[model samples]
Target: MADILLTAVINKFVEIGGNLLFQGGGDLYWFKDDIDWLQREMRHIRAYIDDAKDKATGGDLRVKNLLKDIQELAGDAEDLLDEFLPKFQQSNKCKGAICREFAMQIEKIKKRVDDIDHVRKTYNIIDTSNNNNDCIPLDRRRLFLYAGETEVIGLDDDFNMLQDKLLDQDLPYGVVSIVGMPGLGKTTLAKKLYRHVRDQFECSGLVYVSQQPREREILLDIAKQVGVTEEERKDNLEDNLKSLLKKKRYVILLDDIWDVEIWDYLKLYLPECDSKIGSRIILTSRNSNIGRYVGGGTSLHVLQPLDSKNSFELFTDKIFHFDNNDWANASPNLVNIGRDIVGRCGGIPLAIVVTAGMLRARERTEHAWKRVLERMGHKIHDGCAKVLALSYNDLPIASRPCFLYFGLYPEDHEIRAFDLKNMWIAEKLIVVNSGNRREAEDLAEDVLYDLISRNLIQVAKRTYNGRISSCRIHDLLHSL
Candidate 1:
């Protein structure tokens, strides 16, 4: 940890030193000696810092804090450089005044650097001139596949239950709807279930029903996927689809359905035969209302966020596996850090997977993991937050503020269910019906359940009768 910090500080000092020496239009020559001394001194401290790197990284807080001080002092010097740059850049008549400003800032930075150096020497934290360690840089992420295509964790019961529904030959023309907030693996479950049952069907078609529905294109896509060629469609797209499907048992997967109208438009195009035909439609959507609208409440399958055990498994799987086929043997310390990191993902598969990929390229040391952990909120948002933002933006106006209030609490803190409702009541967020005499608490409870159903807040515990007992918001959602 100290080594990396010292290296970064040294590099920054080198950069500032270069700017002072070369980029200042040669008018700042008077300040060159101070800048050179700063750069050289930082490099000298690097060897000493590197010698104790293992100790600082081994949970030695004092050593870690000292390196942090050095890094911060370097930042102070960088800030002084920033302030001096514009004056050098400007075509000012008073070069002496500009040099004086530079002199004053450099003197302050020098004093701080001198104090740090004195501490180093006093502690016998000295390094020979030739000692320097290899500097490994930090890493970022690349475009990778979404969670839907990856090895799924924490959906065993869901898979079994949905598989039974899809494969039941006795069932009629069935529609099985899988609904949850974005990135909760609705499409992934649909795809997995489709793969499991499609072999039993005479024909299968996986069609993506995006927010904007295009009838002709969708019909053709369905046909193309199910081996119904364009050449076979002599009749209109809809009539031809019904004629083709009615003659054969089939499974059709509609991925990402936004509006109910798309289903209404497409349903007739499917076979109208009775349940004996064994034709089925599997739909995945973020909107639960549309799930019920199309498949009825009985047909809706609300996907839950992954529990801790499975979430960690999925997260580790993403972190270790690479093209080289080498899986990381994570240390216990790294594993503990990883668990804390995965907790922030709130059991959303996509978020966990995305965060794991971000960390995979980094060094598998505690400091590396800690560095990533510190900036996790923003780092996670790179891929997963857009999906979360959709759920946030779609939230009802009244519920939005209530949802934002969850962020105020520490991450993963459980809130008393009644206390949360009463706070909402106190805030007047719950709209009461004048006609009904029920307390505003009832309506507030509705808001809480609404968020839970949407997969935003999770139900921590339940009453004997299965009412919400305690509730907690996800760390990722808390960031939102």
Candidate 2:
């Protein structure tokens, strides 16, 4: 209902503004003032509807009823405009029956809109959130959302084991991969390991080798990070990287490597050498076969979910970030409920944080906490679907439409980076910088990375040059 209603409401406004009646003549005469007023009111209602998505679906009876009212009125607008716009456009003069009908319909729509506003205000059903998420701001594009996100909980053992492997002076130069399901802390653990041990190596570099990683960019990124010298810079990628790494005892982190083909390419530059320098390459992926292929399966860490005690501990930390300490002492009733909520998280760190985000929005009270716990049901992914809903609700107003645009593609579809950017431009979701295509493309790419960081979507493939080549969302997020 939200998708269909939003599309109808927003698209109709665009059409009405761009149609023949919206030209100069009609600007002075028929449909201009009335249509503009209608558009403005509908815009407010659209914002409310966007905000009310969670309430409407989250068992809020009042919001559900209010949405039905809005939906009916929007349907009336669609039907009335469908009949009126064509006839109004066909005729130059407005002295006809069509003009009178549309005018009356628009007035009725306005009155209904006003009444709905009054009711929502009286009942406090209106969204009062002044807080905005920094997921993706359309006006100001932020490229890297994953930085400094390595503040993790309950990975001490994983970190220690991986730390031992990386710092092992007797171990030969090799790869240490972390394997786990999506949303597990494979990437997070790898980041923590790199930060801890990066200073030990002579030099280091990191890159996310998504499914179709571009070889040149991968080599160039590592070369730049490891600080290639003037002499090594004089040679090609293979020689430069090989000369620098095989000699300097560098640590490299290749995240999310899908194919051994990526290893096949990188292996050309990284040679098997003695254990003196203790050079290590850390990797992360869902398929453990990549681990075996890269290092003959020597990695000691496959990231598991936090145990029961750690799950509650992580949840407690995130929930308390939103609530004060006094509330923690006051709400002793929340402990059991908090544990119930953690149980629904099923031990995945991503699930726990996201669930914590849901609780973060509400008051630290039994009623609010129980409401969140009730929504979790039995399954972990069900809790994750709530994460999608909460994340979508928390998205910046302008980014909402662009985020929903992902739903139009087929499930499990690998969306091309440029193609999605062009579509967004054509759809007017992305504002081109003075009609400059390059600027718009950059902004669109930034939006993709921001959403990826939020865990709302996944990177399906990366270009050989290390840009997001194609992307997709999980089946759960897609089901949303």
Best by lDDT: 1
Model 2 C-alpha lDDT per residue in residues 1-480, reported as the tens digit of each score = 454454455556665666555676652255677777777777677676755666766778887888889888877877887777666666655655666766778788889989989877766665433434435222100112137755678988878888887777665446687875566777778888887788988888888776446788778877888888656765676687787676787888888776678888888887563456567888887666678777765663567668899988888788777446734485567777888878766677878887788777777778987877766644435545642454565556556667888889987788987788788767656654255668877887877776765456677888899888888865445655
Candidate 1: Cα lDDT at 351:
88
Q: Spell out the clash pairs found in candidate 2.
A: 213-464, 214-463, 214-464, 214-465
Error of 2 at 376 (Å): 1.7
What's the distance in Å from true for residue 301, model 1?
3.1
The lDDT of each candidate is 0.71, 0.70
Most TM-score-accurate candidate? 1
- Show where candidate 2 strays beyond 4 Å: 1-146, 229-235, 273-276, 322-327, 377-480
Backbone clash total for model 2 is 4
Clashes of each: 1, 4
Candidate 1 per-residue lDDT, tens place, 318-430, comes to 87676443334657787799899988887889888888888878887899999998998666567775567657655664466577777767888999898887775554445
